[model samples]
Target: MTDLRELQFYATPEHPCSYLPRRQAKTLFVDPSAELDQCNYSLLSDLGFRRSGPHIYRPHCEGCSACISARIPVNLFRPNRGQRRVLRRNQDLEMRISEPHFSEELYQLYRRYITARHADGDMYPPSPEQFDSFLIRSNHHTRFYQLHHHERLVAVAVMDQLDQGLSAIYTFFEPEMAHRSLGQYAILRQIEITREHNHPFLYLGYWIRGCQKMAYKTNYRPIQLLINGQWVHCGD
Candidate 1:
């Protein structure tokens, strides 16, 4: 049996629940490292684990069903016309996938993304140290991609490489590019990248129904959900 103690957990201060009407939510996660390979990470992910702050987390509540693991099956994905448009619109943008790096320009874009789209949200105005703590720490094979426009940083996404596919941990983009639908663009790009790499799926952390912010995930037809310890196809 695996030693559960090897996993670490963190506590969150009491705050309003992001999911339910009156639910209090917290996360249990593991500090990720480049050493943690896809096979091991899959074990944790199957148990509802999500990475944030160098940690992989799963909902740990006495009673809760709000958080559910969701992923996109690249083999089954069929981009809708609108999704195709979003991809086409940003074709000029260049994607650079490399080891995670820190930059003032990227930080500035991150700050703008948080302030404009998530000002009151949990991840607001994180200091450079905090940012480094979150992005720089990883277990297993980890990588991040930055979207550049004319050599300017416009967006960034952090991903964990598991044996089967790529897991998208988090992403942020310039608020002024909202019309470009940067959030959706990021996911679509990940799928394309996964396909290029000949990977099977793209793990999109979690998709909480009823949350407007998360509802967009449904638009990506041909998704799969980890239900009752299995992945079931979510038809288009």
Candidate 2:
């Protein structure tokens, strides 16, 4: 086990907060050179750290702590009525878990998703290089959950299988299928996958209160939030 104290971390200067407008945010990142094996990655996750590409980091903003690390205790999670509807809505789609790899098909879908849904976000002008760096660059534990309807691809959820649980790295779906609520369906399916694998939790990255984009995370009942270095159960 790598000692937490032995690992080095660096904090970035305050930048514009991605989730909140007009707010500055700082991030504490694990040393880029650190060898982040599954054991230490799990440890860092327990301490509220999240992985992005090859980097592991957690929010370190001063005076503002809106980004709360959220996870669903799989054994304790019970899908609400709305979530059940999402499951039913996406029942026609088949989910396949596969090793991470790059394909032009996937990239094209990602490009359309970003162009339609996130034109105002940093990932607006999605390119092959950006897609490769953000999602295709994979570690040993990375997996891609591909959702399809017969022959048509609809969604892809990028996940990392950790020692303790699975972390939802990123998910993008067909923007035109808004009626299907594919984003929520992806998370719902991931929770089931975690339970099937006998994992304890499914990390959902950071959930910021009052951020409409993040509010969907709280719908998963009995979520645990890392606060003050401890995990606290909410909405039991």
lDDT of 2 by residue, 1-236 (tens): 56789988999998999899999999999988877689889888899998887778899999988899999999998888988999998899998888877888899889999999889998879999898888877654999999999988899999998899999999999999999999999999999999999999999999998999899899888999998889999987
Locate the minimum summed-lDDT window of 10 residues in model 2: 131-140
TM-score of each: 0.89, 0.97
**Local accuracy of candidate 1 as per-residue lDDT tens digits, 132-193:** 77887665577878998889878898888876788898898988978888888899989988
Candidate 2 whole-model C-alpha lDDT, 0 to 1? 0.90
Model-by-model lDDT, in order?
A: 0.77, 0.90
Q: Report the number of the highest-lDDT candidate.
A: 2
Off by over 4 Å in 1: 1-15, 30-36
Residue 220 lDDT, candidate 1, scale 0-100: 82
**Model 2: colliding residue pairs:** none
Model 1 TM-score, all chains together: 0.89
Q: Backbone collision count in every prediction?
A: 14, 0
